[model samples]
Target: MTRHEQQSRLSNVARVDSFSRDTREFVEASMRGDGCLVRVTHASVGSTDIMARRGDYLLHPFPGFVSGYDFIGIVEFIDRPAQSLGLSVGDRVAGVLPGMGAHATRLRVPSSLLVPVPDGLASEDAATLPLDGVTARHALDLLKPSPRALFINGVSGAVGLLAAQLAALDGVRVSGTASPASAALAMQYGAATFDYGDTQWPRQLLDQVGKVDGVIDHTGSRTLNSVVKRNGRIVRTAFGGPVGHQKAATAAGFAKTLVQRFAQPSEVVCSTPMYVAMKRRSYRRDLTKVLELADSGRLKPLDPVVYDVSHYREALDAAGQPASGKKVVLTFGE
Candidate 1:
């Protein structure tokens, strides 16, 4: 069979076992045959179902009742299909996994789905790119904000923060919701921040900024009822549950809107062209801007909280804590 056919077949038949509370044991069993010992470089566990059986070809879960998604890092010792394609040791990769042990020392992954780290970027920093950065880019492409005002809900989240910055760079006037601390950070990135805690935030925004051209709702809650204009666009990223008749009725009046049921990374964001371009130059350019912002004290790299692989359970707990500012990532050889 050709490589694409082989990949198609493998994808159609890949077996995924669901892990309940014992993800470590489950990962050990999954990797028993031909697995590598990849270090868990970085991980995030929120707003996705924690456990599910993942089909082979389709990296996204079969939709049912689930809460959050899990991503993991693993050290690959043996060459696999991904290695043949260019993924390498100490490459620092990240991809969706069956569950949360990704925060541990190492986890097994199917070779084809892994994304390589861009050259000259730290794994800790690179880890933050895949899930959020790629998603933000995709969502913006979908919305196609054109020098207009954009509103981002939950701007403090990883995806939200990146989305705001990307929009601002596109010459869009950006506004976002966050706590006071996160709002301060968002301000430095060129977005006008709104204190969501204030009961009159919606009214304040309407009075201060008027109707927005597009809204990126990361919270997926219907709290935006009064803020969005009748003729504006709304693009929702959070999938709390099915959109019932009430939401359907409310959304019917909008000129253009979309509710993304899943947040999977699009193939467009992971294409060979994008990857090659990133490795050759674009990745460094964008990241250097971020780093320069950091160096100039304009942008902060999400509060530097480090965690060892062994302390993964604690790290996961820390991630769940409120107002933590980004996440506590795993550091190798520390």
Candidate 2:
């Protein structure tokens, strides 16, 4: 089968085990299999983690598994036949795993899953990329937006920013929702800025942009009134947003709403949804592209709001707070 086909097949088959208290064993771990042991320097708290932490995710149990995913750090140990892929004992790297474990000071993971951090990017900034970068790419591939025009709701968020920049690079006209503080940054990456802080942003978007061919929506169920093409496609990335997804799709009136999930061989995440998600053919190339753009300054750098791992409670709290934007990270100090 072709690579895309292979990726699509894997997407339906790659199951993420539901976290039970037993999975808590992953926390306080030192090594796994023959993977490389990393000395994590910084790990970012994603919104999913926040929802799970606060007992808000309907699917997640209270006080859910460790709250992290993407991380940037150095290699501390590598098991025998010492991993190849150009990884060394001191190489700086970035990675994302399917589930929890990144919140800890250190963890063991395969070198195959890691992308080497370029010379000048900060660890905290790099920490923000694994989840956001990969997720943006994954969402867009599923959205398959035309080269004409695209709109991103909640553009100030990290995934939205990366999605805007990546789409803009391919010659799509991009518009994004932002606040006054984040407007300039949003535009710098090539989005026509719209102030979501305005109560009537949907109307405002209708007045300015007219209609877009596709939308990457993070606004939950808040519909885009008369702003999308007759059959515009939409990819909804926010699960814990203000409104439920079915209502969001109904309100927005999208002709094609993409529903994707990373599930198991026999596991059907949602049947009524009648959709499934896929994994990448390879992410090393995507990671390489992101790092190259970051190093050359084509992509704007994120100044992460950092916390020492020793003070994880505060970091977790900060990630749940809206004041921090999308750049909160936890540092593991020397």
Query: Which lDDT tens digits does candidate 1 get at residues 256-333?
Result: 223222222111112222332334234333433444443454434455356664665565466556342565555544
**Model 2, clash count?**
1
Best by TM-score: 2
Work out the TM-score per prediction. 0.62, 0.74
Error of 1 at 293 (Å): 11
Scored by lDDT, model 2 comes in at 0.63
Cα RMSD for predicted model 1: 9.0
lDDT of 2 by residue, 1-334 (tens): 7985443222111012343322322233223455787777888876666655544444344453455667888887665544557778898888776655577666677666677899898777777777778767666665564537888887778888888878877888899788888888788778888887787877777788777877776544436525666666566665333523333333333322223122110001111111211232256666667877878878765668887766666775677674413578887763
lDDT of 1 at 150: 83
